[model samples]
Target chain A: MIVGERKPLEEIIESLEGAEKVLVAGCGTCVAICMAGGEKEVGMLASELKMAAKLRDMKIEVSEATAQRQCDKEYLDTLKDDVKGKDVVISMACGIGVQYMALNYEPMRVVPAVNTDFLGANLDVGEWAEYCQSCGDCVLADTGGVCPIARCSKSLLNGPCGGSADGKCEIDPETECAWQLIYDRMKALGRLEKLTEIRPPRSWKTSRDGGPRRLVREDQKA
Target chain B: MKSGSNLEKVFEKGEFALTGECGPPRGADLEVVKEKAKHLVGYVDAVNVTDNQTSIVRMSSIGASKVLIDMGLEPVMQMVCRDRNRIAMQSDIFGAYALGIRNMLCLSGDHQIFGNQQDAKNVFDIDSIQLINVVHTMREEGKILGGDDIDGKPEMFIGAAANPFGDPFDFRPIRLAKKVAAGVDFIQTQCIYNMPKFREYMKRVVDMGLHEKCHIMAGITPLKSLPMAKYMAKKVSGIDVPQEILDRMKGVEKKKRAAEGIKLAIEQIQEVKDIEGVDGVHLMAIEWEKKVPEIVEGAGLHPRPQVS
Candidate 1:
């Protein structure tokens, strides 16, 4: 899931300078699961903004509305009525959702209230860790299903560098060395020989190095 | 002789080689490199110029190598993947070769968090093994990574680092074999304070017959003080300073610790020299260049072998 965290209240408030009427929008998908930009968070942000405005002697009115998923146009269309007459739309969704909302409501400034962190999995209550980098190409099959591109601090394709000690990365004692995990997994599966093969230089073109990416499906196109 | 470098020539002649390291100054001072090279000029075959080691910004390895070359000393210029992409790496290779450098050491480099520039973005576009292959392809095939033919290839005696003390201890030898398969001509290991562990690691390397494929140089650094010994044992990653060595250092008087450190380093050199499959010793007198000659002489490795 796309994990995101709400932007600091001060920065969000500063972004709304000179706004008389504001709409605090939320998404019910990934952000909601992460407890960041769900309907409940939207209500809390709206009340806080109203209190801040009152304390500063500013004449401002804040409204709240949430969509099932802001990335989908059909779901965002439901908030059309709530968005009307608002000077600004504060999107409490991931970066993609903010951009989608801005595109759907052309000429309306849709500001992001959350910072999209990464494609990750929630390990526990309020604990999330990145799992993939969306690098168009994936090599999980060869690495015992461990994603070195995302897990390794250096994104090393070959075995662990000299920095692996006690199964921890040299960078931090808390972070587990990704290659060590791969080694352990491969050894458990009796596939240790697979690691002997040297991986060639990665074609970073498939990654962000190739620039902004787009997926085109001719079969699904109208 | 691969690159006809003095180091390669020494190895080709089946002579035990000796290399030294010289870290460029934090500022742009060629004099510092020359001063460091003076201590190692006649005492070693080739000098390794570190590239922003520990991620702290310093004069580039290539720039410092050119300084050594100007002083009539051969330099094994070190290149790290942490700072440059393929294009920049290749460009520097060409430039370094043009300036008379013939030896190169490829490394993944220390993380930037360990350096002064904690906020800097690292460019590990290629790891050390891939970097070794890149240099090999550029030299052997006369083609850049993109498959474009170059007018003149950088004929370098390529080298890579090995850390026998790194974790998943059983896999350390396998990593060395992978480097050998990647076309590395020589291997300089991380500093060895744990002789028993290093001997076991070498036994595995010898069993795999990787020793026949590339020259293996044991890394040696003198512990300047008890504090320095403790730092390496605890703080520095991948470096294993055995408890016995620390206890030995602790037994020495504070004023005599430096002497004890050099004596221990000399003892290590003598033991490593007798180890089968060990090719040489890379003396890294980090910031203590003046003591290199004494350490080399104390180890009975003085009057280095001469090879044309």
Candidate 2:
């Protein structure tokens, strides 16, 4: 899921420097599951902004609204009434949803309230870890389903660098060395011989190195 | 003669090779490199000029290698993948070769988090093994990584690092084999304080016959003090300083610790020289270059084999 966290309240408040009317928009999908930008968070943020304005003796009014998913135009259309007459709309969605809201509500000052972190899995109630880098090309089969591109600090393909010690990375002892995991997994599967084969230099065209990516699906096009 | 470098010549003549290391200064101080080179001029066959080792910003390895070359010392110019992409790496190889650097060491540099520049972004476009392959292809096939022919190849004697102490210990030898397969001509290991573990790792390498494929140099870094020993054992990654050695250092008085450290290093060199697959010693007297000559001579590796 797309993981995101609310931006600092001070930064969010600072962005509304001269705004008199504000809307705290929320999303109900990825951000909601992660407990970051759900309806409850939207209400909390709106209340905090109101209190901040009152303390500063600013004449400001804050409203709250939640959409099923801000990335979709149909879901965003539901917030049209709530967005009207607002000095600014603070989007509490992932980066994609924030951009989508800004594009759909053209000419309106739409600001983001959350910082999109990464594509990750919710490990626990409040714990998440990055799982993939969305590098277009995947080599999970060879690595026993472990993603070295995301897990390894250096994104090493051939094998672990010399820094691997005690099954952890040199950067941080808390972080498990991704190649160790691959080695153990491959060993368990009796595929240790596969690791001996030198992996060629990765062609990073599929990664962010290729620049901002776009997808066109002719089959799904209208 | 693979670049006809002095280190290559030493290995070709079946003489035990000796290499030293010198980290470039944090600024453009050629005197700092030359000063270090003075201690290592005749002591080592080649000196490895590190590239921003530990990720602390320093004069580039290529630039420092030129300085060493000017001082009548051979430099094994170290290149790390963390700071450059394929294009930059290839370009620098040509530039370094053109400047008379005949030896190259490909490495995945220390992460930037360990250095002053914690916020810096890294560019590990290729791992060390791939970097070795890239250099090997440029030198042996006269082609760049893109498979395009080059007007003039770098013709470098490529080297790569090995860590017998890294975890999943059984796989250490396998990693060395991969590097050898990738066309590395030499291997300089991580510092070895745990001789038992290194011997075990080398036994596996010898079993795989990797020793015949490339020259293997055992790394030696004399522990200056108890704190230094503790730091290497606890803080440094991939280095295994045995408890006995730490105890040995602790047994000595504070004033004599440096001498004790040198004594221990010489002893290690003696032991390492006897290892079946070991072909040389890479003594890294980090920031203590003056002590290198003493340690090298004390180890009976002085009057280095003058290979022409």
Candidate 3:
């Protein structure tokens, strides 16, 4: 799922500056499951924003609403009534949500409350770790399920750079070296030879570096 | 024309090349760079100008490279992929060339988290290898990245960094081979304190015949004191200081440790030059740029051969 974290209160407050009618919008999908931008979080942020506005003696109106998923135009249209006459809409969803809301509502200001981190998985209660780089070119079959692009600090296709010690990355000891994990997993699978050969430098044409990517399905599209 | 820099001439002359590193100051102070360049002027073939090394936000490396050029010293401009995107990188390439900087060293810079501005968004749009390919294409094909033709091509002597001490030891040389295949004309490896491991790496490099493909300059960073040695051993990545070297550093008098450090560096230089596949020695004195002359002199590489 897409993982995100709340922006700092100071930055959020500053982003809301000069706004009279502010809407704190939320997404009820991936962000909600990750505990980042659900209805509850939107309510909490709405209260804080109102309290902050009152303390500053600013004549501001902050409203709260959550869509089934702010990424879709249909869901974004559900808030058109409440969003009317708002000075700014503070989105509590991923970057897609913020853009979708901005597209649906032409001139009203739209601000993001969360910084989209990465494609990640929940490790434990309230714990999330990035699992993919969305490179579009997947090589998980060769490395025994380890995602080097996401996990390795340098993202070297060749494996760990000599700084791996005791299976931990040299930069961050708390993080496991992706190459080390690849080696151990490959060894257990009796496929150590797969890693011996030099893996070529990754081609970027299919990755995000090449350009802004899109999926065009002619068969499914109208 | 083949590389016009004196450093390239030294390599072309087939005599062992000796390069020194001079870091730019954090501000617009050109005096520090001039002072450092003056110390390295007659001793080394070329000087490498680091680009915001360690992400501390220094004066641009291209600006410092120009300073070196003004001092009658050749420069190898180090460009890290941590800061600029492709557009900015290509623009800088054209700018640096227009400014008369010749050599270029491609690097995947230190993560921004290690620097003072941890909050700064990193722009790793292209890795070092990709950066090399981009620069190589710009020079050779006379076209910008995305295959667009440019008004003129900027010729440069391409270089890249190699960390032989890092993990999955066998992959180090393979990575070097990849750099060679990617059009790296020269390679400046990570600093060498563990001669045995470096020797092993060089053997692999020679076996793969990478030395014949490109110039391999062994990196030699002098430790100023015991704390520096300890810090390198602990914090610096891809570095392994043998216990004996650390012990030697510990045995020195606090004040004399600087001299001892230079001595150790001299010994390493002499030893690394003897390695079969090694083509040159890159002396990185960090902030102790003044000590570079002594290291070059002690290593018996004084009055560096006039390659012009």
With a 3 Å backbone cut-off (N, CA, C), the pairs that clash in candidate 1 are: none
Q: What is the C-alpha lDDT of each candidate?
A: 0.93, 0.93, 0.87
Better of 1 and 2 by DockQ: 2
Chain B, TM-score, each prediction?
Answer: 0.98, 0.99, 0.98
Q: Which ten residues in a row have the lowest lDDT in candidate 1 chain A?
A: A13-22
Across A38-154, the per-residue lDDT of candidate 2 in tens digits comes to 899999899999898889898889999999999999999999999988899999999988899989988788888999999999988899988899999999999998899999999
TM-score versus the correct structure, for each prediction: 0.98, 0.99, 0.81
Candidate 1 TM-score, C-alpha based: 0.98
Docking outcome class, model 3: acceptable
Candidate 1 chain B, which ten residues in sequence have the lowest lDDT sum?
A: B29-38
Question: Across residues B1-308, which tens digit of lDDT does each residue of candidate 1 receive?
Answer: 67999999999998889999999999997788888889886888999999999999999999999899888788999999998998899999999999999999999999899999999888889889998988898889998887899989899999999999998899999999989988999999999999999999999999999999999999999999999999999999999998999999999899999999999999999999999999999999999998999999999888988886
* lDDT of each residue in A1-222, candidate 3, tens digit only: 999998987899888878888889999998998888999999889888888878989788888899989999999899988899899999999999999899889987999999999999999998999999899999999999999888887676655654676678866889988988898898889997676565544566688777989899998996
User: Candidate 3, which segments miss by more than 4 Å at Cα?
Assistant: A6-28, A37-115, A133-145, A152-171, A177-218, B137-153
